[model samples]
Target: MDYIFLNHTADIYICVSGETKERLFANAVLSMYDIMVEGKRRIEDIRKLKVDCINEEDALVDMLNEFLYLFYTCGFVCVECRVKVDEKLDIEASGYYFDKDKDRLKMEIKAATYEYLRIKKDDKWRANIVFDV
Candidate 1:
């Protein structure tokens, strides 16, 4: 797994890591979806996303919130993504709408919070994120 769940008193916390910044972002999204739903997914839709932030941390949070918006408003569940982190965060996400027959909602994530958000890079890129549930 590229991400792991962490202990949080009032929300969901996860530590996500990847070999690259792009992968880190992608893994973060996947982690969020993993927390919310279960079961198989098919690529029935594709979304192009771009987040403009001052720094990596903001980019990460904004990108996650964007996905959450899609989930709650559009019923879009992203199962996979390709990301590119440059001056702007760019992503191509593929997934399907919530299928009652095939998907199960497990958790409700209100938003990705900046409360304890931290992005770091050593041998790999790592981010600590908190989600308001």
Candidate 2:
């Protein structure tokens, strides 16, 4: 499964699964974008960024939070993304900022929190992510 939303009393949560690590990371970013924007927006500019984390959980938090920072600061929205995770996370992502007056803001994400977070592997990689929205 790609992802599913979970009800949280104070925030929101998502469960994501992928066949590979790269796919898992990409899905996580896509889920976050879905929370932040409404409808589709083409990417006018492409940007690349990287994040280094000590472990998978930290990597997850850093990646999502980075996107949050981008949106809050530059109104950047990710339309498509490809991520590679080694000792660090390298991302090539693209999207244009939505006009405040023209677009609908779906939800505001305060942060990606560690509470109730889990990443597992059985047949495929699975993660439980909670976001402060």
lDDT of each: 0.90, 0.86
Superposed Cα RMSD, model 2:
1.4
- Reference-based TM-score of each model: 0.95, 0.93
Q: Report the alpha-carbon TM-score of model 1 versus the true structure.
A: 0.95
> What value of lDDT does candidate 2 attain over all alpha carbons?
0.86
Taking the tens digit of each residue's C-alpha lDDT, what string does model 1 give over 28-123? 999999989987566899999999967989899899999999988889998889998888888999999997787899999999999888999999
Candidate 1: residue 64 lDDT (0-100): 91
Compose the digit string of candidate 2's lDDT tens values, residues 8-122. Answer: 8888888988889888888898888887788767678887989996798899999999989998899888878899989889998888887887678899889999988888988
Query: Which regions of candidate 2 fall more than 4 Å away from where they truly are?
Result: none
The TM-score measured for candidate 2 stands at 0.93
lDDT of 2 at 78: 86
| lDDT for 79 (candidate 1) | 87
Model 1 score (lDDT)? 0.90
Cα error, residue 47 of model 1, in Å, equals 0.8
